[model samples]
Target: MSKKKLLVYGSIILSMLFWSFSFVWVKIVYLIYNPITTVLLRLIISSILLFIIGKGIKKLQPIKKKDRMQLLLLAFFEPFLYFMGESFGLQLVSSTLGAVIVSTIPLFSPIAAYIFYREKIGIMGLVGILISILGVSVIIFNKNLNLIASPTGIALMFLAVAAAVGYSVVLKNMAAKYNPITLISYQNLLGIALFLPWFFLFDFHDFIYAKPNIKVWIALLELAIFASSLAFILFTYGINHIGITKTNIFINAIPVFTAIFAYFVLDEILTFQKMAGIFIVICGLFLSQAKLNFFRK
Candidate 1:
């Protein structure tokens, strides 16, 4: 691979790593603040940080008038709707399971891409997605092949999955036009606006009364800086360089990373099944990226 390809892969992998850690971070934040409060504050902080960095580096582009609605939709699908589902869902599920569920984003993304953008993934890409999803299933299901997670949590996580697919479709069109900093700055800013009403009505009183400790504060800040700000920027960079379908395939790594993080940070158990599933996921990821002629459509 060329330097450019390596950079793109590195950015996507780093983004997945940050997001995997975010599962743990969100759990820590939930010890004090509710989901709405957590989402709102992180968006506020991330937006400010991104705006300042974007301005300082002279990388932020002015939003064109025609792009306003598209950007609005992007933010709505992502930091707003996605966070709503993910934060609440994580409260009801284990961090590893939550990440595994979210990792299914790539499974649905190709259908959305084909419908909206007519983007086609070869037969190998399809097989890779199924194999990765099966790997995710291995990590989530019991020996009896029954899922062990909360039904409500699973539904909410699927809501997040849908929102992410929508976000990817919209982002594909916009990534080419704007720098990642500008795109994500606007995304979080608009997300904050969208979340304000819910935050005020539901979480504001509780947020004011609750005092988080230094550790919780640190976790929240990490979420803002790494997961919301840097991760999205890197993810946007991937979409710009690699198209929506290929970029989203990297999401499967989140479960593998999250399982490792949860084991160390949250004291979650990592059984042999989980390790095997992780290996399968990595194999699928490599298969998806391979350029073998036999695997082409």
Candidate 2:
């Protein structure tokens, strides 16, 4: 394989690993601090490290006005709305369920692309999307539970999914000018700057008063360093080289890893339905990406 292919594959694999474990880490952090405060703090740490390693801080060049606007939009769709919705959803639903639902982002992305960018939703892709959705629903709501009972949580998770889909579309459109690394890094930095006012107004007490145990602090640190910063770096690289539709497939691993984490850490038992749903979801995602659908387009 060519060097470009190697970079794409490596970036995708790292992105998958980072995201696979991130769901568990965020859930663990929420145990110590509330979602808003926890995510904000994580962002702060990530921004600081990124700034330091990015350069002496001054080495970062000034962003153009248009690109600054793009960065703000990226942050709005990603860290702002996506993380807000996800952290809130995790508070209400299990991490496994949140991971499963978020995995359906690829399904939603094509729909968004179709609507926003005049992209087509091929029959095979549609089939894959439907399969993934049903599988995720099954994984989330086994025979024992009703999906409707936690409508708020379900809605929040979908919002996160939608925000992610929106981010992908935005990135696809913006691919012409800005490098994905600049886009992702700027978004993170902008998100940190945006949260400053909120930090003083809302998270002040939580930041000062909250006493997170060692493990939760460690988890938060991992979230900032590995999951947030490193994952963004790798994902930006992969998304640029491989394209978003192709790169997103590895997100399929997230639900499975989350299930494993839930089983080991949360002591959650996996039901037959959960196992079955996982199959359905994987099938759906595969169908959604089937090459025949691309030909149909």
Best by lDDT: 1
lDDT of all the models against the reference? 0.86, 0.79
Candidate 2 lDDT (Cα, 0 to 1): 0.79
List residue ranges in candidate 1 displaced over 4 A: 124-133, 143-146, 277-297
lDDT score for residue 183 of model 2: 59
Clashing pairs in 1: none
lDDT of 2 by residue, 1-56 (tens): 99879878888888777787888898888776877787788888888887776666
What TM-score fits each model? 0.90, 0.90
Off by over 4 Å in 2: 56-61, 142-145, 197-201, 293-297
Query: In candidate 2, residue 199 scores what lDDT?
Result: 71
Q: Give the per-residue lDDT digits (tens) of candidate 1, residues 1-297.
A: 999999999999999999999999999999999999999999999999988898899998999999999999999999999998999999988898788778778767766876786666556656777787787677767889888777798789989999999998888889989999999999999999999999889988998899899999999999999999999999999989988767887887788789888989989998888788777766776566554333222
Residue 98 CA error for candidate 1 (Å)?
Answer: 1.2
In terms of lDDT, model 1 sits at 0.86
